[model samples]
Target: MLGLDKKDFTLLLIVSALVLLAPLLLNPFPEGSAMAQFNAGYPDLMQRFVIFGIFAIGFNILFGLTGYLSFGHAAFLGAGSYAGMWMLKLLSMNVIPAIIFSTLIAGAISFLIGWISLRRSGIYFSILTLAFAQMAFVLAASVLTPITGGETGLQPALSDPRILPEFLGGGSVTADGNIPKPSLFGIEMTASSEVAVGNWLWTLNWGYYLSGFMMLVAFYIAIRIFRSPFGLMLKAVKSNQQRMSYTGLNTRPYMLACFVISGMYAGLAGGLMAAMDPQVGAERMQWTASGEVVLMTILGGVGTLIGPVLGAGLIKYFENIFSKINKATLEVWFGVFPDWMTDLMVTIVYPFIGKGWHLTLGLMFMAVVIFLPGGLVEGGQKIAKLFSRKKEPETPGGEAKPAE
Candidate 1:
């Protein structure tokens, strides 16, 4: 029954409020605000935030708690996506079965991988996982062409089999029977509807809400794992495996369990991504995608409970927003400055902002690691402490108290 303490409860309340109000807050620029372009309430971007948040949270369970840096996590995610898609193609478009089967399959795959990879520790374990992930990527690209759809990616089509609703009137088959999109109850899970006010437009899609709800559930589970006794054992293993072994605790099973759990989380995220978008690409299993999750987890704060969420949001923001900037937009912003200064600035910054957004992200990540090793959460804590220090002298205990 390990659970949140009072402080943790307060934090959870705050985060819940934020999540609930995110759409409103993100869309409050009056449609013409200078920063309106940066607003994150759009269905696609918001979905990504929650999806990657799940990814980072899952990665945190392994690397943050058990001190195991897995370089092959993307494989589970890709596998889960493919599995979920196959379910959609072969069975009914109900998400429950797809998500469950995807998670279980990913867990099984992780168990096999962990059994082999756990034999090595440190860099060796990392390399083994990397090798495995690369192999998966290659196989998906070639050997698994039928299932994975090869280089063009797996997409929804009319050729899929629909085994549900066998008692249709006269057993008549409809065009919608094949390649059906997943639904909740009877509601379609596809993105639909657009709200436009003056020149501003916002899409209220079912996929966004579905993904958001899933992310909230994922966050709750992560919090539970962080506060659980099992989590403590994993942390102990991370700190000192030899000492844990000396205490008669078998660390291997714990580590393996953690690895499988983490893989399942990644798989869940991948499944949701496919469900929302109805496509699965081989690139999702690439080493670069795995590295992105590692960066998200480390950039936010490795061990802190909420840091991974923050990291996921930040990285995803940059990925979606910054990468969309281009030279034409730069010229528009530079209109405020002198021609020479504007030209100079754009020339210096253009490469890093548009297609080179990754370079900017890399530099910012390095800066965070160098200056705030505890991640953005530590910086926030420091700011809170600074404000609290300023107000403390006004309290009844203004006089210095003796140390215990």
Candidate 2:
């Protein structure tokens, strides 16, 4: 109805429903249960899900549409965070200005980087982006100490000249001794209230809802882009760039535009991060951080619109659950079994949890790559197809039952 095709609009509805119901769906285990650890309905983790979903969505725009795989998207994210943090420190504690500043600054940086890197294609392009990211990380950590706060990272302090906020009859000072938290107008993002129904507790945090609202907006933008003629050109670039070039189309601008847009998305995600936590660290620009978003996109379904969001949530949920499983939790899980069986089972599964969550992630990624390279969305499609085949087709007179 809103210029979206039936399937695309349907997909949007499904995503909207899932996101809206996530607080209840994710915390189904209740307050006191053996499976409570698996519940990921908390505010912070939910924020991460939406933020990373935005990151993966942006990444998919470039990688899925234009076939340009970046190994350094985290640089834009870090740049955005730093920019947002500086805005918070210098101007005001309101998150709106900070996020806006982050998106604009990150877009400019990505434009410059894309202009330089688009000269090369394939692995050379990936390597150039990686080199730029590593340089950013190094400079933030060492050479740019005065600006970036070096190893300590950039943080809001009490001594900054917040001219705008002070003139507005408000400041970062709080009634408590601690530094002020990030806010929207006068409403603090970190402020939250809880809803309780019986043993179930749901946290409704302002930051989470704000992030979720941004996610919906981002998703809508992605849908629009995916349906546009520009998206067709990007797909053409991916399918056959030589033909596009021969047709007198300057593919460089299209590729560069995709890169900058994706980078700006990353920056927006990073700004949300700063808005929630008010902290910016150099580790955010690390190569590993960049790789995680790549994994999110591939593991979700690289080309699909909703796949990246699902993938980001899946990865984040697994990371949250697996990292919390310690020896003690394993013992509690195996308490029903005999001593020897329990010990053996715990011994086998122990390495894949806690600090070993990486092992679990690696195994999961391998399985998805090997069996379902199309990712979770493809797997879901296959399952649906199988179920549909099992349903009996109706005869002219009556519904036909499956043969015994």
The best candidate by lDDT is 2
Query: What TM-score would candidate 1 get against the native?
Result: 0.89
lDDT against the true structure, per candidate, is 0.81, 0.87
Residue range 323-404, candidate 1, lDDT tens digits: 8888988988998999999999899989899899999888878877788777778777766666677876555442332110
Weakest 10 consecutive residues of candidate 2 by summed lDDT: 395-404
Which residue runs does candidate 1 get wrong by more than 4 Å?
1-3, 32-34, 166-179, 192-202, 391-404
- Candidate 2 lDDT over 130-195, as tens digits, reads 999999899999998888888888888888655574433136576675677788877789888889
For every candidate in turn, the CA RMSD to the true structure comes to 5.6, 4.8
